[model samples]
Structure formats: C-alpha cells, structure tokens
Target chain A: MTNPTAAMLVIGDEILSGRTRDANMHHLAGELTKQGVDLKEVRVVSDEADAIVAAVKALSDAYDHVFTSGGIGPTHDDITADCIARAFGVGIDVRDDARALLERHYESTGLELNPARLRMARIPDGARLIDNPVSTAPGFTLGNVHVMAGVPLVFQAMVASVVPTLTGGAPLLSQTLRVNRGEGDIAAVLSQLAADFADLSIGCYPFQVNGAFGANVVVRGTDGGRIDAAVTRLAGELGL
Target chain B: MTNPTAAMLVIGDEILSGRTRDANMHHLAGELTKQGVDLKEVRVVSDEADAIVAAVKALSDAYDHVFTSGGIGPTHDDITADCIARAFGVGIDVRDDARALLERHYESTGLELNPARLRMARIPDGARLIDNPVSTAPGFTLGNVHVMAGVPLVFQAMVASVVPTLTGGAPLLSQTLRVNRGEGDIAAVLSQLAADFADLSIGCYPFQVNGAFGANVVVRGTDGGRIDAAVTRLAGELGL
Candidate 1:
C-alpha cells in the first residue's frame, strides 16, 4: 500500500513577511520523511482567520493527515487555535486539563497564569492534546489535523509526541549519486533511468559550485533494493 | 494604496522528500517585501502535473501576481513549462529567441546543445521571457504568473527582472521592540497596542534566550511614520 499522505499549513505573518526564515517546515519535512508519511503539500499562509480556515479545510479534505505550525502563542496574533475550531465547526473554550497543566507549569516557574497564558488552554471539542516537552503549552490534534507550535524546539517535541501514533507504511528510502556534469549533460540518461524505474521518483537537482556545473541525482522509493539498482545503474552509465 | 499581492508555487520532489531545503522561497519573500509586493501565500508541491496545474490555476486566479520556482530545469521531471501551458490552456513550444540564447551560451561554454539543453527553450505561447543573468536559460512570464528556475541564484535573478516591472505600493516598513518578558506578560498590552494601531501589523515573536523569556514586537506598515508611532506607543505602554 502507498504511504499515508499528509499536508502542512504554516500559519504566520513572520514567514510571509520575510521577517523570519522558517525552520519548522524543513524540520517537519525531514521528520515526516523518516516516519514514512508522504508530505504531499506545504502551504505557508499569513495568520488570517479566513485564510487559515480555508487552507485547513482544503488540506484536511485532500490528505490523510494535516499538520500545522505557528499562530498558537499567547499573543494577539496567535489565532490558529480559534481558526481550527471554525474550520471543523467545533466549539472551543478553555479546557480544564490544559489549564491545569499550564497552571502547574506557571506556578512552579513563578509566572502568573493570566488571561494571555490562559489562551493557551483553549482546546477544540473532541481534540486530543499533543504533548510539548519543551514548553508547557500543549499542541492538540483535532481529527486528522495536528496543530503544533511554531517554535522549532516545541514543534519538534510535538511532532515526536504525535508522529509515532499515526499509521505508517514502509520507510521511504532514497539513494543519491552526485554527477560532476551539467543537468543538460545528465538529463537524457536520468530520464531513461526514471522510465526504467517507473515506480521510483528520480529527481535531478542541478547545482553550481565553485563555478563548475554539477547535479545530484536522487532516486527515491519505498523499496531500498530498487533505489540501489537505480543508483548503481546511474553511476555506471555516468562513468562516475 | 494596498501593495500588489503575490503568491509563490514551489515545485519539486527533492523538497518534498526532504533531500533538499528550499532557499528560493525565503529569497523571494525578502525581495518582494522590499519591493512592496505583499507575498500573501507560498505552496510547495511535488513534481506532479495535476497538483501543479491545480495550484497554478488557484494561485493565478487568487493573487495579482504569482511567482513559481522549480520544475523548469532540463530534467525529465521538469514538467513545469508543460504544466503551465496546460494550466492556462495555451500551446507551448521552443521559441527562436530562447533557443538562440541557449545555443550561444552552450557554444561559448563548450557544452553540446543537445535535446535536453534545448528543452530549456520551450516557452508557453504569449509569454514574455524574463532575463536570467546568472544562467542563460530564460524564465518566462505568462499572464500573471512568473515561472523561474528552482536554483536560488537563477530564481533571485528572475525575481529581480520581474519585480521591478510590477506596480508596487509604498515600501513595507517595520521596526522591532525587544521586550525582556514572556509573551504572556506582554500579551495584554500588546493586544491594546495592536488595536490602537490597526493599520500597522504589530507582530510579537517570542523567544527563550539562555532560559529567559523575551520577545520581539515588530510593527509593519506602508507608512514608516505609522510603524514608528506604533512601536513608540508599545514601548511606552510596556514601560520600557
């Protein structure tokens, strides 16, 4: 069977505005790849209610699982939790368990669990909390969509907490051969290899390093043997 | 006047497979921000025709300008040109101008102008070529979408060629105030500052530096004076 498909919605103006270069998407992409989940699409949208809700619905409907990052902080701009609730037509409010967790963490840290901190306790109806070991503020998984924090450390912790629980297929495997030639010189052979190994995804990423043209030919599929064969054949053909 | 809105479509399997991290998105976002072109959304999809076509249509229809990177190379998987033609229901073929550019560049570089290299000459009908200073292969603009190479250097070059041509509003200005407090402590006052300066987008990005909670409050708007005023008000209100 094919791997479980997934999509990610990155909700934050910082990313879109060039104020921040997002590390979360790259981190999640790597994590999901290891988990054997196929992340088909990733959309970065500014933190707007309508955009978040629309993207959540579209991604949730299209993929087997949806993952979101950002817009969960205790600030005025953090509206991802509310937007997820609206997307699924679920009622959301401060949940006691979440509040207690935040309350306990804040009390121990000598921080007040004020209204702003309390916003972190809002949970959508019928949602399970995704544990965040980095910070006490928890992320929640609502139906097929897993909502997580934007901070790299917190997002990684939440992904670790949630990914193992999802059903996964065979681990996605890949092999690469770096060719010391332009993509133009390597394209034809790569194309033939791609056609021969139809099940595998053969991609050529060309690069210019030190003013010399080269490319990395990556062959990916669930079957490690097929990937090995493709890489071997490519290396032999390229005489590399 | 509101800045012209833009969206970016990143097409590749390497990115989805976690083999490569995209740099073009961040580069374009910064470029557009400086140009006063509001980058509203960014979507990363694999090298699939249907997904690429659907996203092309959706983004093209939604935004004033759509910038696409990747899938424009000479590899067999580089189907972006064909997909763009199909998305707009237009015919595409190698144009004389593009072919000549590639022919001259390849000849000068002593690389054979093979069929794979010739593939770069294909341009959708009614499209205008965007100059690529880094590489000879030209990116093209069709309708509202500007399709550029996935390579960071080439993509940035194409962006430079295209962005200056678009009608831009006032430059997006911003100033940040660093608060040595947790987001929870700063949230209430930040909310009031946001409301008071609704025209300026006041964004609070929190951080944990050496185990101390802190945040950077960024105020952005077309008017530099307004951004400064919002930051000043926020700093005063926070007693900083």
Candidate 2:
C-alpha cells in the first residue's frame, strides 16, 4: 500500500515577515518521515483569516492529514481556531471538556483562567483534544486536521500525542553514497541507475566544502532489499 | 499605495525529506521586507515536475512577484527550468546567452562544459537572465517569476542582482515593546490599543523565559510617525 500523505500549514505573521525562522515545519517533516507518513507539501502564511481558511480547506481536502502550527494562542491575532472552524463549516465555542482541562491546569499553577486564556478552550464542534504536556492549553484534532501550538516545545509534545493515533505505512528506507566528484561528472551513470530501479527515488545533491566539489547520491524506497541492491550498483558504477 | 505583494515557491526533495533545512526562504523574506514588498505566502514543494508547475502557476497568479529556489542544477532531478516553461506554456531550450556565460566561466576555471552542465543553460523563451556571481549557471525571470539557485551563496547573489531591477514601495516600519507579563494579562489593553491604531498592524507574541511569561507587542506600518505614535501610546499604557 502507498504511504499516507500529509500536508503542513504554518500560520504566523512572524514567519511571513521574516521575524521568525520556522522550526516547526522541519521538526514535523522529520517526525512524520519517521512515522511512515509522506509529507508532500508545506505552506507558511501570514496570520490572516482568509489566508488561513483557504489554506486549511485546500490542504484538508487534498491530503490524508493536515497539520497546522501557530496562531492558536490567547491574543486577538490568535485566530487559527476560528478560521479552522469556519473552514470546516462547524460551530465553535468554549467547550466544557476543554475548559475543564485548562481550569485544572491553571488552578494547579495558581493562575487565573481569564477571558483571554479561556479563549484557548474555544474549540470547533466535534474535535478531540490533543494533550499538551508542556503547557495547559490543548491542541485539537478535527477531521484529519490536527491543530497544534506554535511554540516548538508545545508543538513537539502535541505531535507526540497525535502520532500514535495515526495509521502509518511502511517507513521509507534510504541509503546515501558520497561521490567526491561534480554532479555533472556522475549524472549519466546515476540517470541510468535511476531508470533501472524505477521503484526507488534517486536524488543527487551537490555540495562545495572547503573549495572541494562533491555530490551525495541518495536512493530511497520502501523496500530495504531494493534500496540496498540499488545502492550497491550505484557504488559499483561510481567505483567507490 | 498598498505595498506590492510577493510569494515564494521553494522546490526541493531534501527539504521535504527533512535532510536539509531551507535557508533561502528566510533570506528572501528579509530581503523582500526590506524592499517594501509584502511577502504574503510561501510554499515548499518537492522537485517533481507537476508539483513545481502547479506551485509556480498558483503563486504567479496570486502575487505581484514570485521567487523560486532550487532544482536548477545539473542532474536528472534538476527539472525546474522545464517545469517553469510548461507552467507558462512557453518553449524552452539552451539559450545562447546563458550557454556563452557558462562556457566562459568553465573555460576560465579549467572545467569541462559537459552535457549535464550544459543543461543549466536551458531557459524559457522571452525570459531575462538573472546574473549569478557565485556560480556560472544563470537564473531567469519570466513574467513575475524569478527562478534562482538553491545554494545560499548563489541564491543571495541572484537576489541582489534581481531586486534592484524591480520597483519598490515605501519601506515597512515597525516598533516593538516587550511587556514582562503573560499575553492574557495584557490582552485587553493591547486589543484596545490595536483598535485605536487601526492603520497599523499590532501583533502580540507570547514568550517564556526563566519560568516567567512575557509578550512582545509589535506595531507595523508604512508610516513612521504613525508607528512611532502607536509605540509611544503602547509604552504609556504598559507603564514602561
């Protein structure tokens, strides 16, 4: 069976403005790869409601799973939940279950459950809460769309809670052969190898380190034996 | 006048597979912001032809300018130039100008201008070449789409060469105030302040340092005086 495909939507003005270098997308991509999910596309948009709504709807409809990060906080600009609810055509409110979770967390920490903080409890209808072990505010899963916080720590924790529930396919296997030659020098052999092993994905990444040019040829596939055999043939062709 | 909007399409498989973190997006974002161009959206798609073509078409239609990085290399997977041509329904081939530039650079460097390396000279019809000081391979500008290299040094050089040719708007001005309190604690006052400065964009970003929570309130506008006045009022309200 083909691996489940996923898309990530990162919502934030900071990222779009170049004020923040997005760490969540890289983190999520690595994590999803390890879980046998193919992360096909990623989008980073400003914290605009229309943009968020459009991106959420498009990704949700196209991919098996859509994960979003950021804009789920307690400020006026934190409008991700509302936009998501609108995208799914569902009503949203401060649900009792979510409020209870926040209430308990704040009470234990001696913090007030103020209106702004309570806003985090306003989840879309028919959504399951994803636990936030680092902070009290919980993320939610709504119809294959997993909404998570922007903070790296909280986002990582939420991913931990969410990944186990997902049905993953066979993990992608890869092997790399480093050829200390320019990609142009090795292109013909690699191209023929790629055509031979049509099932595997062959990619050549060029690099220049300390004024030395080289290429790392990576072969990826789900089947370990196929990838191993392809790598062997690639190594032989390169005479490495 | 409203600032001209721009979108970035990053094409690569290493980024999607989490083998490499993208540096071009952040670099381009900062440069575009400095040029008074509003970077509205960014999408990272794999090095597949269909994916690149789809992203290029979408971004080109939505924004005033679209910048693409990656896949313009000398390997089989380097299909960005062809995809760009397909996206615009234009004919593409190894242009004389680009080929001449590569030939000169290769001759000077004592390197072979082999078939694979020559593939980098392929460019769409009716496109202007963007100079690459770091490498001989030239990027091209077709319509509003500026396609550049994925390597940071070459990408930066290409951006420097291309940005000056485009018209710019008033530079975006911003002021930030750090309030050493939770975002919820300052939400009401900030919300009112944001309403008062409707001409400016006020965003509150929450942070936690040494177990103490605080928020950074940033006010951005094209007008320096308005941004300054808004920051003064915000400082007064926060008693800072």
Candidate 3:
C-alpha cells in the first residue's frame, strides 16, 4: 500500500508579506512525521478567497489529508472557513455547537460576545470540530481538509487535539551522518550509492563552517533495515 | 504603486520528511521585506522534474520574481537546472564560464573533479549565474526566476549576491504590540479597527504562555505614519 499522504496549506498575508516567519509548517511536518503520515507538499499563499478555494480543492483531491493553517480569525481577511466551505460545495452557517463553545468562552470572561466574534462560530455542513483549549474558536475538519487558525499557538493546540484521533502507518525511520567534506568531493560515490539504494532517499545538505564547505548526508525510509543499509553503504562510500 | 510580488519554490523531499525545518524561507522573506519586495507565495514540491517545471512556469507568470530553493546539487534528484531549462523551453549546455568557476573551485581544494561533479557546470542559454562563494555550484537567474541551492548557507550566499540587482518599492514598515490577553477578547474591536484603516494590515497572532492565552497585534504598511496611528489606536482599544 502507498504511504498515507498529507499536505499543508498556510493561508495568511502575514506570512507572505514577511511580517510572520511561519512556525505552522515546521510544527505540522514534525507532528505528521511522528504519526507516520507522509507530508508530500506545502503551499503558503496570501489570504485571497479565490486562491484559498483553488488550493483547498486541488490539495484535498491530491492528498488523503490536508491541513490548512491561518486565515481563520475574526478579521475580514480570515475567510478560510468560508472559502473552504465554498470549495466543498457546502453551505456555511453558524452552528449550535460552535456557538455554545464561543458562548461558554465569553461567559467566563465577562465580555459581551459581538456578532463579529460569532463569525468564528460559523461552520461548514458535515464538518467535525477540533477542540481548542487555548482559544474559544474551534478548528474543523471538513471532508479531507482540516482548517485551523493562523496563529501558530492556536493552530498547534488544534493539531494536538486532532492528531490523536488519526489512524497512521509505520513511523518514518531516518539517520543522519555529518560530513566535513564539501558536496562536490562526495558527488560521484554518493550518486552511485543512491542509485543502488533505490528504496531509500539520500539528501545532501551543505553547510558553511568558518567560510569552508561542509555537508550532512541524511538517509530516510519507512523500513528501519533499509535506512540502516543505506546509511552504512553511504558511510562506506565516503570512506568513513 | 503596486507591491513588487515574489514567490518561492522549495524543491526537496528532506523538508517533507520533517528531517529539515527550512530556514531559507524566513531569511528570504525578511530580506525581501527590507528590499521592498513582497514575497506573496511559497510552494514546496518534491524533487520531481515535472513538478518543478510546472511550478516554475506558473509562478513566474504570476509574480514579478520567483525564487526557488533546492534541487541544485550534483545528485540524481538534483534536476532543478534541467527542469528550469525545460520550463522556459530552452536548451542547457555546459558553459565555459561555469566550467571555469567549477575548475577553479576544484583546483583550490586539490580534489579530483569527476564527470558527475562537472554536472554543476551545466547552464541554460541566456541565464545569468548567481554567485555562490560558499559552494562551487552557482545558482542562476533565468527570466524572473532565481534558482538557488537548498543548503541554507549557500542559499543565503546566493540570495545576497542576487537580491540587490532587483527593483523594489518602499520598504514595508511594521509595529508590533504584545498583549497578555486572548485574541477572542479583542477580536471584534480589532476587526472594526482593521476596516477603519484601509491602508494598514492588522494581524493578530496568539501565543501560549505558561498555559495561559495571549496575543501579539502587528500593524503593517508602507506608510510609517499609518502603521503608527493604527498601532496607537489598537493599543488604546485594548487598554494596554
């Protein structure tokens, strides 16, 4: 069977404008890897309704699971929930469960909940809510796409709430060997070694140390035995 | 004047596997912002030739500049150069200038340059090489797209070499204020304030502190006066 595939869509102008260096993608990638879900793709787009709808439809169709962060706020640009609803061809209305959650949250704070805040209570039909203990506004899973808040903290909290319920495959196995040599020095042997181990992925990440070149060879695979074999072969090829 | 839009295409499987959290996006975003270039989008695709080609064409047409990271290595999966050439409907050949650079780099290191290592010397017709002082494999700019290596250090070096050549608008100005209050508490007023300020973008980012909810409000714009005014009004509304 093919590995379970997932994609992340970071929808926010804050991220795109360089105002926010996104933590959502890194956090989601790590969490998904631990759960054995293969994160195949990630796209960070501005909070445009058309762009969000198009990306949502395309990614939802391509992957088994799609996680979207950002644009789910009370602000005008927070159109992710509505755009996602439109993508699914479903009607969006303020749901009782969502309103109840928002109401309880506001009741405790002694702040009168305005209609704008109630916008967070809007839910697409046939969607299940993901609890957010950190904030009142809940994230929801509609069809294959999971829509969460733009804020990293809120997004992470919602992800933690949702991840436990997912059925996962075998955990991804990986090994890394740091090499002091430049990538060019190890290019030939590394290519041949990579070709020999077709099942494992060999990635060469170069770094600079004191204005000199260095690289790290990372070998990853679902099977531990295959990953180990690849790493061993790579090390031998490097004459380590 | 319209904001100078830019997009980034990150080509790698290591990122998807969660082994590497990309540092280049944040770096580039911050750099572009200072240069008055708006980084509008970012897409991370695997080292698939077709995917790279398609993304290059799509993003290049849509934005003023397309910055790509990764898949510029000498390994088999490093198909970005060829894919980019194909995307632009051009032919790639080993150029004397690139070959000279590679030859010099190899001679300085006293390493025997194999045929596979020389693959880095291949350049597409009509492309300009972007300097990579850290590594011999130089990135290049073809049309509006700038293709660089995945390695953070080398990628940064290439970006430094190329960014100053591009035309940009006014630098985006931003002011951030942190409030030890939940986003939900200030969601309504923030939304209204955002509507009132047509020029400034008000972004609400929530944070978690010792299991308590808090948020940071960031106001961004090209006009420093407008950003300051929005921030002042927001702070007053929040009673901070």
lDDT of 2 by residue, A74-118 (tens): 888999999999999999999999999989988997878999899
lDDT sort, best first? 1, 2, 3
DockQ (0 to 1) for model 2: 0.80
Which candidate comes out best when scored by DockQ?
A: 1
Give the CA lDDT, 0 to 100, for residue B57 in model 1: 100
lDDT of 1 by residue, B1-240 (tens): 778999999998788777888898888888899888999999999999999999999999999999999988888999999999999999999999999999899989999999999999999999999999998999999999999999998898898899988888888888989999999999999898889888989898888888898899988998888887887788888888
In model 3, which runs have C-alpha deviations exceeding 4 angstroms? Answer: A109-111
Q: Tens digits of per-residue lDDT for model 2 on B1-240?
A: 988999999998888888889998888888888898999999999888888999999999999999999999999999999999999999999999999999998899888999999999999999999999877799999999999999888899999998767787887778888899888778888888878989999998877788788888889889999999988988898899
Model 2 spans > 4 angstroms off: none
Better of 1 and 2 by lDDT: 1
TM (B chain), model 3: 0.98
**Model 3 clashing residue pairs (backbone):** A70-A150
Number of clashing residue pairs, candidate 3:
1
TM-score ranking, high to low: 1, 2, 3
Worst 10 residues of 3 chain B by lDDT: B181-190
TM-score of chain A by itself in each prediction: 0.98, 0.98, 0.96
The count of residue-pair clashes in candidate 2 stands at: 0
